[model samples]
Target chain A: AQTVTQSQPEMSVQEAETVTLSCTYDTSESDYYLFWYKQPPSRQMILVIRQEAYKQQNATENRFSVNFQKAAKSFSLKISDSQLGDAAMYFCASGANSKLTFGKGITLSVRP
Target chain B: NAGVTQTPKFRILKIGQSMTLQCTQDMNHNYMYWYRQDPGMGLKLIYYSVGAGITDKGEVPNGYNVSRSTTEDFPLRLELAAPSQTSVYFCASSQWTSGGPAYNEQFFGPGTRLTVL
Candidate 1:
């Protein structure tokens, strides 16, 4: 079974600063997809970014990007120039064959 | 597009009560899934359907039942609600492809919050 772990339960960053949320996974499959999802207080889940296991280059979407290390089984999300709106619960997920395994998630707080 | 819609955004039920949570997707996606998120916990897959008429168990499938009679609708049924089942439920759908991008990028609906007393 595939499992995802996010060690940090809570994270805080000042506005305009950068923050990184750590994630790690255990999967026997060689090929899979890793993702970061954001859920604000409105309770809507939105995709932040995604990284393919085979890709060496990290995935970036605006201020959101991932440091995906396949060998270490680590996938961390980096939020740059964090804004107040960036405060939310972030989840790391791994997917294959329509099944998605998610980490416990990290609650991010941005202080202005 | 309405994307994926889950009805009854919030629901409260007494123990042993039964209810059905309705989910519909307008994207014409061939894959649908049901997941529950506990407080401070990650979402856990309850059930998934590749397409209409095909449903399968996920990591945590106990106390949950689902039916996919039509491509657009996948309803989850709870025969007897329990306190442990109190959590936020999300419905998601994605396009089906042999492999790669389409299969992994799932669009999620605004979750339904349920509380069992």
Candidate 2:
């Protein structure tokens, strides 16, 4: 069984600041993938970033990046230069054997 | 590319009623999935298909049924809609090439909101 955990229920960040959302996962598979997805008010799920377990280098997409510590089973997302549009629900997921287990998610609010 | 699309942006069903949620992908992905998101919760997979005519149950597959007749379509059916079934459903697709750059990164649909009374 695979399980992802996001401990914080909500987080607030000021404009132009940076925020890091923590996520931890447990999986038996040696080879797998990690992902961060964003769901806005429009109910659209968008992919934020992804990391492959085989790769030692972390994944970064523009202002979004992930700190993936494979040995510790921790994958946290960092959002740099946060804007008001960053406010949404972020979910972390672990994928293996064609299935993904997601965390409960954390709500992010941006202050201007 | 239309990516992934789901029909019926919003729907309301009475208890005991049945409905099918339609999903389609034009990216020619080999893997497709169905997931439901409840209030203040993460998305849970209900079903998935690796290719045409190959369907499998996911984490939460009790009340939902799914079929993948073609490479482009995967439909989920609810036999008996209940209050617990009220949630937003998402359809996603991904390519599964071993050691591919975009492997396992799923592309999602806009999601369909369903409420059962």
Candidate with best TM-score: 1
Q: List the residue pairs that clash in candidate 2.
A: none
Clashes of 1: 0
Winner by DockQ: 1
Worst 10 residues of 1 chain B by lDDT: B96-105
Could you tell me which residue pairs clash in candidate 1? none
In terms of docking quality, how is candidate 1 classified? Answer: medium
Q: Candidate 2's residue-wise lDDT over B4-110, tens digit each?
A: 99999999999999999999999999999999999999999999999999999988899999988899999999998999999999999998975654346788999
Off by over 4 Å in 1: B99-102
How many clashing pairs per prediction, in order?
0, 0
Please provide, for model 1 over A1-112, each residue's C-alpha lDDT reduced to its tens digit, 9 standing for 90 to 100.
6899999999999999999999999987777889999999998999999998888999999988889889999999999999999999999999877679999999999999
Ten-residue stretch with the least lDDT total in model 2 chain A: A93-102
